[model samples]
Target chain A: MSEDPGSPKPIVTFLGPVASYTHQATLDAFSSSDFTLTPVVTIDDVFASVQSGTSHRGVVPFENSSNGSVVFTLDLFADLQHKYPDIIVCGESYIAVQHCLLGHPDSHHASHPISVSERTGGSRVGSGVIESPLSSGAVTPTSAIPNPQKPTARPVGDLARIKKLYSHPQAWGQCKIFLNAYLKGVERQDVSSTSRAAQLVAEDLTGESAAVSSVIAAKIHGLEVLARGIEDRGDNTTRFFVIRKRAEAEVGDATSVDRKEIGKDEQGEGDWKTLVSFTIDHANPGSLAHSLAVFEKYGLNLTSINTRPSGVENWNYIFFVELKGRREEGIEDGPVNKALKSLYGVCRSWRWLGSWENRLAR
Target chain B: MSEDPGSPKPIVTFLGPVASYTHQATLDAFSSSDFTLTPVVTIDDVFASVQSGTSHRGVVPFENSSNGSVVFTLDLFADLQHKYPDIIVCGESYIAVQHCLLGHPDSHHASHPISVSERTGGSRVGSGVIESPLSSGAVTPTSAIPNPQKPTARPVGDLARIKKLYSHPQAWGQCKIFLNAYLKGVERQDVSSTSRAAQLVAEDLTGESAAVSSVIAAKIHGLEVLARGIEDRGDNTTRFFVIRKRAEAEVGDATSVDRKEIGKDEQGEGDWKTLVSFTIDHANPGSLAHSLAVFEKYGLNLTSINTRPSGVENWNYIFFVELKGRREEGIEDGPVNKALKSLYGVCRSWRWLGSWENRLAR
Candidate 1:
C-alpha cells in the first residue's frame, strides 16, 4: 500500500530462507525496487507477520502441481474471515520448480562445475539468483540478514561417495525415480524444509551428506550442485499467493453494488479467480451438489475445489471452491459476487478467502 | 480370498511396526484367528503385497478426520482401475486416535503407571492390545517379529525431564496446544511414524527422550505413558479400508445386471458408499460443473469429494467422489452404478477405485 515515490520500501515477508520456491515467487510478485523482502520460517509466520502489521505483504505457496493442495495454508483459512479481518490475497505468482542435488562444495566432485546439458537427458538450471534484495540496506539494521557459512574445504568425489541425503519430505517423493536409480542405498534424512536441507548440507562438517534443493538455494548457501532437474516431471511447478491487508470500505462492495460491468475477457482464460470455503449440512442429501450448482446459475466457471477437516468434528469437512470471473471488472459486477452473495442462503457457514488476478503464467 | 477353515490363514499386510494406528485398524478389520497379520513399513508396500498376490488382503489408512484425505492413498488409485484390477475395497474400519507422551518406562516419572483419569483434564486410555497377534503361530516363522529393546534404565522426573521429543510430523500439529503449554522449547525430533517414535524412545538408553504415540505402542514397547490423551481433540479418528483381490466375473455387475434389484434401505442411513475418481476437460469452462451435475441426475448423494494431482500434467486433477447407495442393493442396482455409468460420458476419463459400506462409526 505504500508504493509512493521515496516512501520507505515496505517489508514483504515470505516462507523462506532466501532460496525456496516461495522466495522465487516473492521476487516475481512485487518488483524488487518497490518493496524490501524478508524471510520467515513457516507459512504461519508469513500470515502472522502480515496479520500483525509487522510486514506489508506475505507470499505463501498455495498449491503444488504434483503434491496437490498445501493443506496447511488452506487449514489456516478456516474462520479466517473473522480471525484476520484485513488480510486478502492481492496477486499470485507461479514458480517453475526444478530440484537439484546439492552438496558441500568441498565434499562433491565434478572435476569442475558442469552444465547439466553435458549429462544425458539433462537441462541447464538457470543459476537463479536475487541480487541483494535482502542484502540491500532497504531492510533495517534490526532485521536479521541471512549470513550463510562460506565453504572452505576442498573437493571430494561423486554420488557414490555420499552416505546420507538430507531433503524435505516432499522432495523425496518428487525425486523418487532418480533416487531409486542413482542413489539407491543412500540414507535419507528429512529436514523441515528444502531451505533447511540446503542449510544442513552447508553446515555438514561430514562432507558425506547432500540435499535436494533449488539451484538458487545451492547458490545462496554456497553449496555445489551435483544434479539438476531431479524431480520426476520436467514441468513441475508450485503456485503462490501474494497477500496484503485490505481495508473493508475500500472493498466498495456491500452497499453500492456494481451489476454487470465485468471488464475485458469474458472467456475463462483471463478471468480473475475468487476462492471461498464453506460447510454445509453434509448429512443432508444433495447439499454439496446444490451448493456447486449455484456457481453454474450465476455463470461462474468452477476452476478448482478442495476439502479439509473442519476441526469441529470427525469426517465433517470444509470445502474450498475457486471460480473464474471476468478480469477487467470489479467482482461485484460479475457472477463471482452474485454467487458468493447467494451462498449465505445455501451454505451452513462460509468465508470469502480472496480474489486475485489470474496471473497463472508458467 | 482364501479364508478356508483348514487353509493356512491368509496373510493380511498393513502399514506398520506392530502398534501404529494401521496395526489397530488391521486388528479391527480381520479376526486374528482367521488371518495371519504382517507389517509393511510403507503404504505402498501394503498395496504392493496385495497387488503382487503375496498377501491375501491389505489394510491402509484411507483418511483422518483432523488430517483430511490421505493423498498418498488417493493418488495410488489414479490408475488403479486397470493397474491393479480385482484389488477392490471390501470393508472398512475406524480407529479412534489418542496420542500419548511415552518414555522408557524405567526412565519415566510416576513411581507407578497412573491412569490418565488422575490428571487434571485426563481420561483413561483403553490400553488397547492385540495379544500376540504378531507373535502367535498365526504369522509364519520367517515373518520379522517386533522385538523391542528391553529398557534396563530407571525412572526420571516429569515433562521438564524430557530433553527431546520424538513424533511423526502429523502428530506434532495435533498436539501443539499441549506441547506449547507443558513441553515448550523441548527439541522435537521427527521419526517416520508414531510407532517409530515409540521404538526410538524404547531404545534410548540415556532416558532423556519421549515420544507422541498410541497407548498400544507404549504397552508393546515396554514404555511408560507419561501423559495420555494428549491430542488436541478427544474424538480424533482415522478411517481405513480393507482390500482383497476378487475373482473377475464374481462381480455380478454387467451381464445379469442388478439394475432394478434395489436393497431394503433407500435412505442414506445404512447405505453403502462408492468411491470413484475422474478427470474432466479442465480447459472447458463448464466441464467440471457439468460432471458434478451428473451425480444430481442420478439422485446420488455425494458423501465425500477430494481432488489430487492427476500427475499426467500440472494442475490436471483427479477427483475422488464418494456417494451413498442402498445397503441391500448391489452397486449396479442403485444410483451409484447409474451415476458411475454416466460419468464415462461426462468426465474426460474415470476410474472406479472401490466401494464399501459407509462405516463412519465413531
Candidate 2:
C-alpha cells in the first residue's frame, strides 16, 4: 500500500496516560517520526480505537514473565474477534521491567537518611542508591545525612517517612520483597496504571507519598527516583502485541497475495506462532484431549495453553492454544487444517485470534 | 476421629478482615457453634495459619463464574503443597454474589433521588430498584425524594453524589454496568477487600462516599444498603474450598483407613472431584495432550483446566487440572491410577492437590 505524501501519519493507540509499559512497547515497535503515538486510559480503549478505524494500530500487554498471562486481554480477544474480525496480531515485542521508588523531587525530606536502628533484618538496608543506567558501578548514596561514626554501615534513604504507596496491583506483586521488608504497614493505594501512580505522587508534591514505577515514568512526571531495580525478580519482563486492521493486497506488487495467504509462503521456516481459541463439550470425557491430539498427529508444536471460564455455567471453559506456525501454509492447509477441521466437528466453537512472527526468535 | 469433650472447638481461618466473601463461604461450610471462625489479613495468611497449625482448617476462594480462576490462590496452592503436604482439601462450597451500593445511614442525602439528566447512556438508567430476598416480588425504591410531577417515573437513589467508589477490583468489574451508568467519572479507589470498602464508607459518615459490597458486609460494618443486586449478571457466584490437616484413623471406627486410602470407598459414587497440578516437557510436541489422554482412557471426566507460568522461563507453564472422581477408589487402583502412573513417567513433575466430595452434587 502506497502512502499519500500529504496524508497524516497513522496513529498508534496504547494503554496509557503516558510512559506506561505499553507506551514503551509501542515506541519499540514503531518509530515516533513515522507514527503518532497516542495514550488511552484503558486496554479496552486501545482495542476500541483500532476497531473504530481511528487508529491504525494498537499496542497491549499479553503476558508477564513472573505473573503469567494477562487474562483480561485474552478474554477481550475472545469477545471482540467476532465483531472486529479484520484486526489481527501483526508483531510482538518484549520490555524489561525495572520498578523504581519515585518521590517528589523538591520535597525537603526526599534525601533524609534512614536511621540504622529502624533497618529491619533481611531488608535491603544498604546505602539507598538510585541505580540508573547512566550511573557508575559504585553505589552513589542519595541520603543527605552521612554518618561518619559508622563507616562500615552505609546510610540509606528513609522509606518509613512515606505514609502512602501508590502503584498498579501488578507492581505491588513485583515489588513484594521491597514492600514486605522496608515499607510494611504503609497504605498501598491501587491505581489504574503505574504511570498514573507516578503522576499522582508528582502532582501531590508530598514527601510523605511514593510510587512504584519506572524511571521513564518518573522522568515524564517530573518525579525523583529514590531507588531503582526494586522488583523481586531480576528477569521481570512483559510481552506486548502490535495489532492492526487486516488489509487487502495492493494492485502494483506482482508477488502480493490475498490477506488470507499472507503468511503461506513464509510457513515451515519455523519463525511464526498462531493463536487459536476453542470451546469443547464439557459433558464428553477427553473431548479437549482428543482435539489436542490432532496437533500431535500434524507434528505441530503447542507452545502455550490457557483456559478461562466461558461465563455460561460453572466448570465451562474456553481454551486458548498457541501453536508454532503461521496461519496459511503452516496451519490453514495440510495437517494443521485437518486437525482444525476435525476440531470443528467435535468442539462447540472455535476461532483463530491471529498469526504473527514469533518474537522469541529475536 | 473422636472429639474430646474438653477440647477447644476447631479454629477455621479465612481471607478476611471479616464480612468478605471468604468469611461468608466459611460460615456456609461449618457452623459457628462447632468452629471458632477467625479472620486473617490476606490469602497467604490463611495458608500460613493452616501450615503453622494455628488453625485446624482454612477457607479460600477457588473460582468465580464470571471472572474465571483466582490465579493467586492457584499459585499459592502450587507453592504451599510442597511444604504443607498434609493440609488437604476437605470440602467445597459456593456462595451467590449479590453486590449492593452501601452508604452511612446517618448521612443527610443518603436517599437523594438520582437526576435523570445526570446519567450517561451506557450507565444503568431508569428506576434503580434495590432487590432484596426479604422484599416481596415488588421493586423497593429507597429514594427520599419522590417527584410527584412524574407519577409513572420511579425516583431512584442518586449515585452522582458519591465522590468516591470503594471496592475490591473484582467487585468493580461485577458492578460496571451500574457504575458506568450513574457514577460515570467518579474516582474509584481499590481496597484490600470488598468488606474493607464497606467498613471505610461506614466509618467516614460522609454523605459523599459509597462502596460496592454485599448486603451482609454492609450490615456487618453498620452501613445501610442503598441498592442491592446491582451486579451485571444474576449468575455471579464464587466457589470456595475447605482445607484441613490430615488426621490419622482412630481404633474404634470401622470405616477408618490410612490417608492414602481416604477416597477409595467414596469412588464410583459420582460425588467427588480431585485437583492435580503437573508440569510437562515443553520441548516435546503434544506431551500435555498425551498425558491428558490417560484421563479419557480411565473414563474419568475432566471438569476444568488452567495454566500459570511456573516462573522458571518463558513459554514454560504448570497446568492445573480438576477431574470428576475421588482419590482412593476412583484414582488409586483403577484407570485413574494407571493414567497418573503413565503421566508420572512422561511428565517432568506432578502433584496431587487434594480430593474432596463434590459440592455441586449437593
Candidate 3:
C-alpha cells in the first residue's frame, strides 16, 4: 500500500494478522483510499504508537455483551490519557459473535450408546424378579452379559456428571457461575481459543470432554454438539472502537473553490458518539458526582462511564465517558462543551473520542 | 468434614481441588464447620448438584472487573430456572486479583534493560528502546564506543525479532491495543495463565518473545520485568456469586443461629447484598418496565442489571438484578416482593445471590 506522504488520512493501528477479526473490523471502518491501516500486536503498542507519533490513532476492544469491561483497555485509557494529551477515543463499533458448538463427526455416538433392555417378569408376583440382558452374545439365555464389542456409548449425563469442560478463558469466565452449578463436580480448563477448545473436544477419544465455544468452532472442528444455546445472556454483543487522530477542523473559507467540488454524497447523515476523558482535581468528597454533573447539566445521555485511579498519589481519578452528540453539529460550541470548558480548573483534560454511526448499524 | 444427618449444614458445591480461590471463598462465606462443602468440576455441576439434591448450594464467578459477566453462567440460570422452580440465589462475593509475573531466571534479562538511559550532548532526547548486541569482548572510550561487550540496546523490533508474545488471553486482549501499537507487526499468543506466559517468555531461547501478563507471573517465572501495569483499566476487579437451593424457611432460621455464633468473633456487622433473577411474561409490552418499578417503589438501590433471552422460544427473557437488602433483616418486604409474588402471571422466578463484606466494600 503506497500513498502520498502529505495525505489527510491518519494511520490507525489495530491488533491483526490480516484476516483476524480486528483487521476485518478495521477494513469495515475505513476504505483503502481514505485511511492507512497498520496492524499492531498489543494494546500497549497502540498507546505508545499514538503517544510516540508512529501512528495517529489505535483501536482495541473495550467491552462485550457477555463480558463486562475489557479492564485492561479501560485501564490504559484511564491511566495514560492525562500524561499524553494527544490521545483520545474517537468512536466505537458493536460486533455480534455468532457462536456454536462443534466436535468430531459422530463423537456423541462413540461416547454414548442407546441399548434396548428386554426384561422377563412374573418370577415373584407384583414384586417379580425380572432379568434384563446386556447386549452381548451369551451361551445361556438367562446369563447376564456386558457389551464388550459394542462401541462405547457414554450417556451425556446431567451437568453433574461432566468431568471436563473447555473454552477460551474469557468465554469460560463469563459462563463461570452457571457452569459451577450444573457441572458441580467437573474440571474446567482454558484452551487457546474457543475454536481450539472445540477442536480438542472433537478429537477426544472418550467423549468425556466437551467445549463451550462458538458455533463456528464446532462447524470447523466437525464435532457433535452435546448442548447448545449455553450463554447467560441473549443480547450477547461486543463493542469495538475505531480510534483515529482527532479530525482536523474543516477549513470552509480556505476551501471556497473546493466547496463546489465537494459531492453531496459526503453529506450523509451520521449518528454521533462523543467520548471524553477527564480527571477530577481531587478524590475526596463528591468529586466524582461533581464531575458527572457537567454532563448532566447539558442534558447529555452518558452511555458509559469507566474510571481508573490516575496512579498518581491520593486517589486522583481519570474517567472515560461516552456521551451522545457531535461537535460538527454546532455541538463543539454547544452548552455541553461550554460547560466542560468552564470546569477547566476542576477538570484535568477533556478530549473527545469522535462520533460516527456504525457502518453495520447503518 | 463429618456431621450428623439430622443437623445437616448447608452444602455448596463448586469446582475445586480445595486450594482453588473459589473453594476458599466458599469456605469464607459459609464457614468450613457450619456447612458441608462439596467440590464439583464446572459451574453447571454446582447448579446441578443443588438441583439434584446432592448439595444445597454452589459458588462461581459471574463477572470480573478485568473481564465481564460470565455469559454462560447467566444463560444457565435463565434456562434451568424454567426446569426447576425452587432454585434461588443467596449471596455474592467480590475478590481482588493481585497478579505477579513469573518466568525462568536465565532469560530474565532477555528484554530491554529497565533503567534510565544516559545520553551525551546535554541529554535533550530520550526514548525507550529494545536492543541486543552480539559483541562479547570489546572496550573503547564512552563517547566513541557503541557498547559491544554486552547487548547494546536497540529499539525492540517486530515479533519476527521476538519469538512470541505471551500472557493470559484476557490480559493479551486488554493490552492488545497497546501490544499491536508497539509490536505493530508481530505474533501474539495466549498461555493458560499470566504466570505461564511469563514462564514461557523466559524459557524462549530465541530471545525474541515477551509476555504481557501480571506482575505475579514475572515473580513466579523468574523473568525480568519488561513492562508493568499493562491493563487498560486500573480498577480491575471480578465479582463472584454463591448460589444454592432455597433452604426451607426453617433452615434459613437455623442458619441465623450459625451466623450469631460466628458473629461473636468477627464484629457481627455483616452487610447483606440481595441478588434476584426473574422473568417477565415475554408477551407483555410494558411488562419489564412495570416489574422494575417494584424496586423503585421500595427505594431499593439497584446495583447491577443484566438481561438474558430465554433460549426456549416464546417464554423469553431472564433478568438478573443485584439489590441491597436481606429477607430476614425485616428490611421491610414492601411492595417489590409482594408485587413480584402478585405478578404470578408474569414473574417467573426470583432468588438471592448472598452478599458479604470483608476488607472490601461491595
Q: Candidate 2 on B62-132: residue-level lDDT in tens?
A: 88887788887888877723666556676788898878878754235334533344432334432223332
> What tens digits encode model 2's per-residue C-alpha lDDT throughout A95-200?
9998888876423532443334442332443222232222122223354424312212221444545668889877887776666656766767778789999999
Q: List candidate 3 stretches off by more than 4 Å.
A: A1-10, A56-59, A62-72, A80-85, A91-239, A247-270, A276-321, A327-352, A358-362, B1-9, B51-53, B61-241, B246-257, B260-362
The local lDDT score (0 to 100) that residue A225 gets in candidate 1 is 71
The positional error of residue B83 in candidate 2, measured at the CA in angstroms, is: 3.4
DockQ of predicted candidate 1: 0.45
Say which candidate scores most in lDDT. Answer: 2
Error of 3 at B265 (Å): 7.7
Candidate 2: chain B TM-score against the reference chain B: 0.79
- In model 3 chain B, the worst 10-residue window by lDDT is B134-143
Off by over 4 Å in 1: A1-7, A80-82, A106-165, A181-192, A250-270, A326-333, B1-7, B80-82, B105-156, B159-166, B180-192, B250-269, B326-333
Higher-ranked by TM-score: 1 or 3: 1
Per-residue CA lDDT of model 3 for A1-362, tens digit only, reads 22248876667777543333455456655555655777665566676777677675566776665555565676666655454445555545565553332333332432454333211132221211112223331112221224211221111222222346776555754554444334433445655456557766867776566777664555566665544444555445566675544434521111232222212124534445566777665423234445555665565555555555455532244666665555454456775466566657546566555554333342
Model 2 residue A286 CA deviation (Å) reads 2.5
A1-362, model 1: which lDDT tens digit per residue? 23345657677898887788888888876656656778888888888888888787799988888788888788776643356656667667888888877876431323444332332122122121122222221211121323211111111123444667888777877776666656665656666579888998889876777888987888788887766677776677889987776654544231111112122123534547777788988877888888888888887778889999877777878999887863223546567777777888877887676776687643
Per-candidate Cα RMSD to the true structure, in Å, reads 11.6, 7.3, 13.6
Across residues B1-362, which tens digit of lDDT does each residue of candidate 3 receive? 23258866766676553434465557666666766777665567777777777776677766656455565577666654555444556555555543322223323233443232321112222222323331211111123325321222122211223435665554554443344434443445644445456666777765667766554445555565443343445454555666666655511532553352223233434445456677665444345545555665465545455655444432244677655544453333543355445445545555544433322342
Model 3 scores a TM of: 0.53
